[model samples]
Target: MHRTAVVPCATPPRATRRLALALAPCAVTTAPRAWAARETASTMTPGTIRKQIFNDARGRATTYPPWMLGEWTCATTFVDASFPRRDVDARALARVPDTPGFRALSVARVPDVGREGTIEHRVRFVRVDGKTREDVGFNLMEIIDAYVGADAVEAVTTDGDDRTTIRLKPRASPNAERIELFTNARESGVEGDAFYVRESFRQVSLGYGTEYGNARVAPTDYEHRWTYTPLPDVPGGAVDETNVNKVHVKLVTAAYVQGQDALRLTASSNPRGAPVPKLGDAAGLAFEPVIVYTHVSLLERVGCVP
Candidate 1:
């Protein structure tokens, strides 16, 4: 499942270096009462993500543990991808650009789909209600614009409830002019230093039909589960100028195609305009795992901390 691929050189920008040094230590040294009492065995482990269903109709924003707070420069490498349900077929094994399954899974492109390599990005986390919460709006705009292109992403916005929406500019397709995406956390929890959260998204590719009904809007639903485990700090990893400790964490992220969206997208010749039919209860259905990415990151406290 692993093949060698090009890895981007590791070097932080001048602005990033300045931000890292300006940050003050904000992570709580001791486990808070709420965090210490909530440790459980259900947190996911690497290579252990199986088919398990749950209901999260009224999910809310995730509250993270103290150790997870801060800005981080992450270098993520794609591990592998597979179609557990639709195996033994050409479409199941197709590359990211060669198939619409990735789009249906709410993924624009799978970095190094045919191989394994690293991509670097920066992310920020801030204190909320005495805990930690990621800045979704800023993070998505920074990451996605870099992943695709600044010209492709028109805007990225987050609501008061933490729901995020991304708008894309027009493409070359005659029938479509733009795309919109709505995403939010469906469920989240912390089991000791390990944290897990499921994020659901609805991606709508808008077509240029004259009328609203005939606009050819294609709505696709998918979700991703991320499991994070903090690693112990090393002695020499601390910066001398800042005197701030760095936190390390192992992150495992799995993308899943909910219900029949993936099946319909893969079967359609023109997937961009395809209609996704409503299915039965989402919790009762089995999700198709499309991609699993794993990475270990070095997190540094930044001035973004509240």
Candidate 2:
């Protein structure tokens, strides 16, 4: 076959159906944009990254002008819940108010059912500026969820939803993270002005079993404002989606843990020691925090990497 569909649509159909995982190809999906000098945005500044692009939530045209970065090629049209609250407009509902990431649902159960998909982005922009050591000031795009419709990209087939390289950093403060080890586990966003990074994915080792406690993956985010050169009404350099400016939400959390932080997150798959990867599975013993897939992207920037 001549594969290159990468249509995980940034995954969000219940994490492509409980992790039937597969969609890699995109020249090996992620892990190359300087793989992780991301000390979790160390503490992003630059006037809090230009006051988080003036988070009017999606109003003042969402504000932009922090010196726009590089790369460009984003074409997403996901407005789940079958997109039609009469075409949402309270400033893009301030970026998916609820629906986890818009129309999101299916952390698997309890009358759960809601999802949406459509992804096309091969983003790339790095501007950490923390000064060398691979800079870590802020702005670190890296999307990559190709395949744009056109025959639903041949019906799509991959399901290996391991976050599909979906790593967006920007959280001066927001990850309240109440606690939930399954069923839509906890995660929320919109610390406005910058920091609209939502996430989900809790299926584990499921070649056909071990759902790793299923926190019901499928949820997405990675917000950023604009600056001098964009907003010709968005969609530039190709691929487009009608009126554009759309987003939704989701959530259902439950799972909980105690006991020395569950024996300190099972003795280190990263229980605060940091490096990242502290959920469950791989014998670390599952209590919660696990991961898998669920994406819905739109970065747009195919340049500037030097």
Candidate 3:
């Protein structure tokens, strides 16, 4: 959970409630060390296996290098979105548009299915006890409220250590409530001077029904990888001319959904009485990527966190 290498801290970042997604660190075993192979803009594309070089965090709380800690303004652009599976059942893929992940794209103003949009938001990372971590609940509440509405978010709660739940007011009817659960996370980092992180999570949304009716349950997985290359804090050294202290970020986000058969099987079972059926076979276990969002940003230090 501790990092050995400490980069010099920049100026403090000021906090604000704006539109942005702050991809953060998670549990892992090894402290971040420098990698022989650097992550550059060209190499940080989606579907790349470069992240595999880092050690898995395996659901343990971890920290980032000193340079990455603090509040920053994240200016992101939605670059692409696609559902590229020809072999899967068409009927199953049809339901993808109704899921929360697809709905979020609309909220993010992704233009047409293949177009792009830009949004700006704030993110804060604090150093505690010589280790750094994110304010997860605060970030979720701000993001949901910004995209949906101020009244859309009901509560953001955390259990034990890693589990987090964001409860939202039902979008359709007052009789329903929507819940997003971040159950488990795997975050890994390369050793040394690199500021790269690859984090994945298993998330589920419930009661996210459409106008027809409330969706009983929708399970999804998300993989977020960020390749951050730091910039010098000298005059005209920043990616954004206004901010001398900054880091360039390449962020790729992918959403995956289980096959229809597995979803139906899981839905039909009773969690109170019987154990949910396991996805033992390849077909059942196959989680197809339905949406991918790629964006580049300059994280400028707005303020420092104590």
Q: Top lDDT: which candidate number?
A: 3
lDDT of 3 at 135: 59
Alpha carbon lDDT at 132, candidate 1 = 76
Candidate 3, position 88, lDDT: 34
* Model 2: lDDT of residue 147: 25
Q: Per-residue lDDT tens digits of candidate 3, residues 167-275?
A: 6655522312555454354455753434666555555556644557646565555566677777777755434323436877766655555555445433434667854
lDDT of 1 by residue, 100-158 (tens): 22332134322122222455566677787776787665565455444443433455555
Q: How many residue pairs clash (N, CA or C atoms closer than 3 angstroms) in each of the candidate models, in the order given?
A: 0, 32, 20
What C-alpha lDDT does candidate 1 achieve relative to the native structure? 0.44
TM-score-wise, the better of 1 and 3 is 3
Could you tell which candidate, 1 or 2, scores higher by TM-score?
A: 1
Q: Tell me, what's the RMSD of every candidate? A: 13.1, 19.5, 11.9
Model 1 lowest lDDT segment of ten: 27-36
Candidate 3 overall Cα lDDT vs. reference?
0.48
